[model samples]
Target: MAFIERYSRRTRWFHAGIYVAVLVLLATGWWLALGREGRPSPLARVTGLADTTVHLWTGWGLAGLAGVAVTVGVRAAGTFLVESVRFRRGDLRWFVRWPAAVWTGRFASHDGHFDPGQRVANLVLTGCLAVLIGSGVGLAFIDGGIGFVVLRQIHRWATFALTPVVVGHIVIASGILPGYRGVARSMHGGRLRVETAKRVWPGWLHRTQNR
Candidate 1:
């Protein structure tokens, strides 16, 4: 039997907001980046603004939201990161055995608050967001008496650098993970099934028994 606990409602709200903001920023950003110069984007035209302005404002909004989300995610995910990912002999064993476990659906045998794959995903996202945010800030400040041409180049390069990670994140979150429904529910309801907690996190049950 799986144990159940609810994620914080506030956390879920922030997560959902960030997801919406990021997706909007990314879509509008692409139009602004790839659309022909002087030809207003169809999407921007529909939205009744120039695509470039939409992209700029939305990018700023996404950056702010991401900062908030990262602060919260770091705190929420810290425990699993430290305990489950510390260099342990058994961690290597689990890493080596992960493929077979996946094929056989034996996630329980390799125990932790988060599976190794989940840990990897977390790291990827954390690192990518760091880069994205840093680059965004640098890009934003490049044009205010810092030289327009240089700043524009820096902004372009930063955008190029961030694209691959963004694509990879989308693919893994939407296409690859088995816990998509649970993840969706976590965002929607701020709660997960007891079965999920049991399968992925036997430890939490013990710790949260009093609460």
Candidate 2:
């Protein structure tokens, strides 16, 4: 029945802030893209700003937040980077067994803080976010040129690509799947029962304890 420490307060705060910003950006960006430039959704109504304005400011804010995280929460950022980059033996087996594990409450063991799937998720989400931020900034700063048009198109496609991946990540992290039940609490300074932790992330638990 023992529990292990998972996310730190700072880590959790940054995580929540970043995701909230991304969600806001997505809503505004998609609304503007689908509607006329002057038209805005209720999400835009609440913000009391034009959709493009909201999206632009939010993107800048996210970039600043990321900078702050890297500077102020350097330790946590480093740990996350190290963990996400790590790949170890048995990782391939973990991915191969992931489908059945989704409903079986049994996950294959592998090394490191992140499972193989999570490492892939980390890389993908990072790439998408980088593309989003880069293109968003370019679109916001540049005006009336082919470059701006190109950036806008890139941002559009990046949003299209990121949406489903983010949704899937949400589904998994929410622990709605049978195999991941009780796993949701591991984020945001929460913990999991020893058994639940072991079942879902045996390698992480082992590494955390041993380290």
All candidates: TM-score: 0.68, 0.93
- Number of the top-ranking candidate, with lDDT as the measure: 2
The 10-residue segment with the lowest total lDDT in model 1: 175-184
At residue 167, candidate 1 shows an lDDT of 74
Candidate 1: residue 168 lDDT (0-100)? 58
For each candidate, the alpha-carbon lDDT, in order, equals 0.59, 0.83
lDDT of 2 by residue, 160-179 (tens): 98888888888998889999
Error of 2 at 96 (Å): 1.0
Taking every candidate in turn, the Cα RMSD to the unseen true structure, in Å, is 4.3, 1.6
lDDT, residue 180, model 1: 31
Where does candidate 2 stray beyond 4 Å? none
| Candidate 2 residue pairs in backbone clash | none
